[model samples]
Target: MQSAIETARKQLPKIRIELVDCYTGSAAQALIALTAARAVKLGDNLNQIIPKVNKVIPEAEITLVLDTLKYLERGGRAPKIGAWATSLLKIKPVVTNRMGHAHFLGMARSRTQGIERMIRTMRGKIGLNRVSAIIIHSELETEAKELEHRLRSEFNCNETYVTEISAVVAVHLGPGAIGIAFLPS
Candidate 1:
């Protein structure tokens, strides 16, 4: 997985693949594109985020990515705060690596709602005024398309894409799961 990410980073200098190193249920696929690089006269925050993965498993890394809370609950990884919040606040968090560890970016509600929440965060953090999009899903093509459409429309993006969550992530997120990735203007 790390090697593939390195290759993608090199080929798409602007793109970086950041695998979700958290608990999930996406165990169907074994290959996932971490990022798609873009040409740039200057590097942006999203570009800055394209560092190579620091670690790799001895056997392999799963392709699809799944939601975390459920797996965390089953595995006793995440605490009651995130689980309780999921039910009480309907918060679906975007998981990201923090200093080689998985941390919750923020809370979101539904799938599209979560993507919308991430869009807001991406706009503020990366200033994605003009950029393409990608949607990673879990056997949910219809939802993925709708999500892509919404993202394209709301962000005025040139491209919106989707991919199934990797086997690693799906093992945690369960069946119905999805996510979106993109860069800045």
Candidate 2:
């Protein structure tokens, strides 16, 4: 079935959309994330850095090719304890922005479990009922569809879609990455 982003793009007017840089890997995520910024270094240099960081944040609003935390573990950014624990349990961590950096949200033991986690996160933050539009991107359509399904089933967001990740974006996510980006209402 078509996704909410697909339908929205096909049926509604375009907003002069532009596909910019994509971010992946925890180091890059740590460098680019703006979700939960603490000024530890920044705070000390607040008077100096705040202005500089602000100028960078909007442009740094990177399209994170969100990935399963395993890749991050292999990259050596994730804590060994969490990685080992998840591996022992066959769990996948749901990653998202933390202080504008990439961090773990929760664990998903399976694909369906991941979708529920994703949908719950989106719904809680943006509200399934009032979602403005969605950008459903993935390394493969089959997996991407699950995200579309969640949006459609929960929010009537039939406009969702599946699109290929760019080469630059792929560099970080590698293959088989599925990313869903939503604009805040």
Q: Estimate each model's TM-score.
A: 0.53, 0.52
Point out the worst 10-residue segment of candidate 2 by lDDT. 16-25
Show the lowest summed lDDT stretch of 10 residues, model 1: 53-62
Q: What is the C-alpha lDDT of each candidate?
A: 0.53, 0.50
Candidate 2 residue 177 Cα shift, in angstroms, is 3.9
lDDT of 1: 0.53
Tens digit of per-residue lDDT, candidate 1, span 1-185: 78988888889896554665422222211111232123122443443533321121111112212344766666666777666666566556666432334556666556655666666655664454565456777788897888777776677576555777668756656666666555332
Quick one: best lDDT, which candidate?
1
TM-score (C-alpha, index-matched) for candidate 2: 0.52
